[model samples]
Target: MSAEVRELVRTYLPEFPIQYCKSLVTDTTQFMSIDYGHVIELGDVHYMVYKNEAERRFGLEDPKYWVKRCHELETGKRKILKLEFFETFPVQVGKFRVECYRSPDKESRILDIVRGDSRFMQGITIKDAAGRNVRVLEIVNGRRLDLTVDRIDVEHDVYFREHLPGLLRRYLEAVRAIGMLHRHGERHGDIRRDHLYVEHGTGNLCWIDFDYTFHSYEHPFGLDLFGLGNILVFLVGKANITVQSLEGMGLAERLEGRLSSDDLSIVIPNRIVNLRKIYPYVPEALNRVLMHFSNSAEVFYTTTDELLADLEPCVEALESEYGRKPE
Candidate 1:
């Protein structure tokens, strides 16, 4: 079965040398071996060549056909009955892994945005054997800030203090990246700790996932700033207190029980309490900035530049005090 799939891959992409091939198995019954087929890697590129049975069942022979079907569904022109059968394969191009989109138009737009900005994950479009327009993006080799913070020893004051300067610097860089996006008249509608990546070795920060980004003509950018504040809270407090976490904690129920029925101001003071409780080591100056921005009513920073300006002084002070001097 593996050999057969390898032959299929070679037939489709004969130019590249096949480096490795592995059969993807779904189940093994007592009498039958249900092999989903082989995912073959040719040089730096990977392709999932489905078995004959799987191809007949899923109609995945022509990638573009399914992509067009998705477009019809999205535009309300068609309704899909069985959506579970759909699956996507990842391909590698150069240094990045490519996610092929069904809609050539959507893929083209994404590629344009990525190519126009260096802050975004680099991407390109290529036509597959079936002439399907596929989008491939460079895989970011770094850890998300949220995951990175979880691994830090925040409980140890000295250890955390020593590393705080570098963390603050990276945080500033992340903010600056967002500011750059705004200057280009784009808004990253979705900004979270996981979306911001600190590149390995270089320590350069890059933003990923632009599925929700859109052009905003408005000058005041608060939503992204609000996200930046949440990121700061994560960095300084070493805690993941997001809207999802709040929802899980029954924040709505608590607010209903405590606040007056007529009072429109729905303030959550306990958020600050939790930050201070979890990270007692957070400096007072930094804490003030976090609290001010995190509070929706404060209106402390209308733009990313203002937030960066306010944050720079605090970060610089921390670097001077705790940063290791060059030997």
Candidate 2:
């Protein structure tokens, strides 16, 4: 399948080198549902082009829905149906706001939350060269911030120490971004370390991946806080505290056997063990922050503001103690 995808891409884009090809799958379902086309990467740009007969064979609608909607506004009824089939590529307006799904409803919901926020990536609709309506978002040129840290040779203690302050600053900024979302009564339903990015050249921190985000009016704020704490753990520990690791440490089995059904008590202890094993040099102040939020204490932060207040001083203390002097 991958070979076929590569060949198809070569036929269409002969000028560009096919860096890689992956079987594109739809996320709207729990079970894996392969899409009609493969997501191909040529140099730095990526495209999702379907095969010639894919639309017919798969009964897929036009991926470019906004294009037709523009025509509707000009001639026919302006009332666009809220159907799921119209969403296609990332419509490039002023910036690049890529919608991963075909549902306009999801795009509208996400835009309503993050459209104007500087901390979050922004998006807008625009007309393409074919006079079709499309959406675009501000492109983040850098790789995931965690990837940068992960690439660092941890054995070179001096290198790790030199970069620690900058990593800490980015971490704090990420926490603040999440806090801003919470302040607006929203929750970043997915808060993994990969979702936070450090912009290339500018070193600006921004959050991405709002596909799972939703209003948090009635939801507990602890999920985001806990996620933030885990991110901090990843930073200070210098390694991911994954579920597989927890299970290896026998923490998962213990939690399953001992913990109550509703109790969210298993995260912190497992994190502490992993942190100690992989990155025991994690500072006391930062360690406390991770512990406080992930522990089973009832007094976990109710607002990101509270978490930020506690985290800022810790950041300062770490920088003062171990930060390298600027060149």
- The per-prediction CA RMSD against the true structure, in angstroms, equals 13.0, 12.4
lDDT tens readout by residue for model 2, 103-179: 44444456567777656766554332333323334555666767767787745355446776777776777778777
Listed in order, each prediction's TM-score against the native is 0.57, 0.57
Query: CA lDDT of each candidate?
Result: 0.51, 0.51
Q: Which stretches of candidate 1 lie over 4 Å from their true place?
A: 1-46, 49-119, 126-133, 154-156, 214-220, 241-270, 273-281, 324-327
What TM-score number comes out for model 1?
A: 0.57
Q: How many backbone collisions does model 2 have?
A: 12
* Residue-by-residue lDDT tens digits, candidate 1, 1-327: 367546655665454345544453221111022212334222234435323211111223532222111111112222111111123454331122434222334434555765755556665555444443444455567776666666766454654567667877877877887776677666665677777877777666678655443222332455566667767766765564543354565565554354331111112233442344334566777766775644333345668888888789988887777874210
- In angstroms, give how far residue 302 of model 1 lies from its true place: 2.6
